[model samples]
Target: MTTRARASTMAVPAQRRLQSWIKQSRGYLFIAPAVIFLLVVMVYPLANVFVTSFTQIDTRERTQEYVGLDNYAALLDDSTLWNSVRNTVIFTAASVVLHLLIGGVLALLLNEQWLSAEVRNFTRGVLILPWLFSTAASALIWGLLYHPFGTLNYLLMSSGLASEPVEFLGDRALALMSLVLVNVWKTFPFYMVMILGGLQSIPVELYEVSRVDGAGRLQRFRHITLPMMRPVILAISTIDIITTFGHFDLVKLMTFGGPIRSTETIAYYVWQTGFRDVNFGYGAAISVMMVVVLSIGVLVYLRMFTAREQMYGETTTAL
Candidate 1:
């Protein structure tokens, strides 16, 4: 090759390298703020929680004493901890299932073009009001409604459904169920919103095509709607599970784990152990266990979901 041609070829590579460097530098510059923010806000606190979970640190203890795995061992023997685990599982599963079912139904109804847009929008607004309200305020309102002489009881008695007012929150049997109902009510709107978004993204042509092919409403939903909505449903269900599992405020305000420890979820148990019982080390252990449990659940969800998604392609019909 001529000297000039060789020089031109070498220069072209250098120019490309320079462009690559500039692109990488710009990408790093854009992400640097977010990386630093997460490290400071999320990573630091999470690291602290992890470190604390291994030590004996209480209010009276001025310094953390390294206790190795003793806290974890103690957790294994703690009946209250196990009870909290059971309750947490129950609460999470029940709330998530109910939320998905109710939300899916509502989303389907709202997505129907035959329904008036004004009516759909109004219902959406009304449903979302619960989610917009402060958790503490909502809990208090629900607590009042569950009172012996409360609106719910009054309505039940007036409707001849009950001879007397039922002690909804005070009764151990009823308290957990009542809290579950309240949680389902509070979170269903979130699922509804998510599912509605998924439904809106689905093409109208797909539904019309299904109908033209002699598919009934239920068949269309089973075949077309569900397949399209799977990813969104899985995403929402995972979020619902995590949120319901870790929930504390509503339960604390409504029943405070009730007459019995029936409603005591892991989150409340952690607070009670740490702040109430002043056993910081035990509470930290509980927190660690909660994290571990949630992590496992998330892993299982991802594995199962990914496998399902692969087995049945993204748009494969459920029917």
Candidate 2:
């Protein structure tokens, strides 16, 4: 080949490669702000937590000392840790289940054509009002509702449902469940909105086709709705589980982890241990353990996502 021809050929590919690199770099540049924000807000704090977990942080003395695995050992021996875990597990399970079932029902109901478009939109907006309220505000509102002479008790008594006021928060037997109900009321709207969005995305033609195949409402829901909503269900459920498991403020504000610590959770325990008791080392250990526990959930979610993607990819390629 001639020297000029060789140079020209090399120049074309080099320029093309440079252009490709620039295009890829532009995409990264767009995401760079988000990446930087995540590092500063999430990654850095988490790295700090991991490091702090191995150290003794004395707030009064203003000192931090490396203590290694002693904190982890203390956590293993702590009875309250197990209790908090139990409460957290129960809270998460009940909250997530109710969120899914009730949210699914509300989403399905809201999707119906029976309501006028304006009415439906207005109703959806009202339902989300609970979710938009700050957690502290919602907790305070529920605290009022749970009081002996509160609106709920007065209505119940006046309607002959109960003759006396019910101490919802003070009764140990009822405290946890009472708190769960309040949390569900506050957060279920988020699930409803998410599932409603999922429902909207479902092809209307599928429902029509199912009807033509002589499927009833229940059958259509089973065969069409449930199957199609699998992805949304997985995503929302994973998010809710983590949040519910780590839930602190509402329980803290409403019950103060009270009625003999029956409603105390992992997050509350961590806060008490680290902040209240000033046992920063032990609290950091609890915090680390909580992350390890939550990681199991994240792993499960990732596995489901991967499996779904593989199945979807296969189905797409086959078609």
Candidate 3:
């Protein structure tokens, strides 16, 4: 090969490398604005919260003084904080379980061939309406439904189910459950939509194969559908768990953590402490704690989910 030809070949490869570098740099450039926006909008505020958590600050004070662990120590001693923790846990668990179960069932129903395409689409469209509604609006509608002399109470009396009105939100016993039901109704459609997409992605051949092998409906669901849905369910449940734990709007609008703080959650507790009570330091501390707790919880849940899947798969294979 001539020296000129060799030089040209080397130059061509170098030019291609430069072009590739420019392309990669351009990709980063496209995302730079979003990254900067997030830093400005999200990271800076989070850093402020973390810093404020260690300071003694409130609406009454014009100045903030570093208080070290005072806020966290106070939080540990607070009974209401503990109560909010419990309520938050219960709310999250119930909401997630209902979201998955109801969403899964609805997805199954919609996936059925028995329903005509038009009927199925219309039903799905209706189911998504609740999710379409703003959280504030949904809260108001549910609030009316739970009113002492509202439609729900009137219906009960009309049907002779009860002689008088039921205090759905007013009574402490039913308040938490009532709020949970509303949260479930407003959010379950998201799970339904995601799971439905997962269901659609599942190959029809699996069910056909199972049927040809004389697998019953229950068997097919157990061995085929459940396994197929494991990943999708895991992802959906994780997102639901995180968001539900931090869920604020529905609880705030419906109950305001009312009836003696029976329905209080971490989100509401933080708001009440920071905004309403104006205990900025304490509220920031709680917010930080929420982040820590949620992180640990998600890790634990993922670990358990993976372990259970392994065990279940082994058992099924053995069977």
On lDDT, the leading prediction is: 3
Query: lDDT tens string, model 1, 233-261?
Result: 88888887878889998878887876789
Query: How does each model score on lDDT?
Result: 0.86, 0.88, 0.91
Return the clash pairs for model 1, or none: none
Better of 1 and 3 by TM-score: 1
Error of 1 at 117 (Å): 1.6
Which residue segments of model 1 deviate by more than 4 Å?
1-26, 315-319
Candidate 3: global Cα-lDDT? 0.91
User: TM-score for all predictions?
Assistant: 0.89, 0.85, 0.87
Ranking by lDDT: 3, 2, 1
Predicted candidate 2 versus true structure: per-residue lDDT over 1-319, tens digit per residue: 9999999999999999999999989989999999999999999988998898899986878999999899998988899999999999999989999999989899998999989999999999998888888988888898898899899999999999998888899898888998889889998999999999999998999999999999999999987887778778878988898888889987778888888998999999999988899887888889989999889877876677658767765221211
TM-score attained by model 1: 0.89
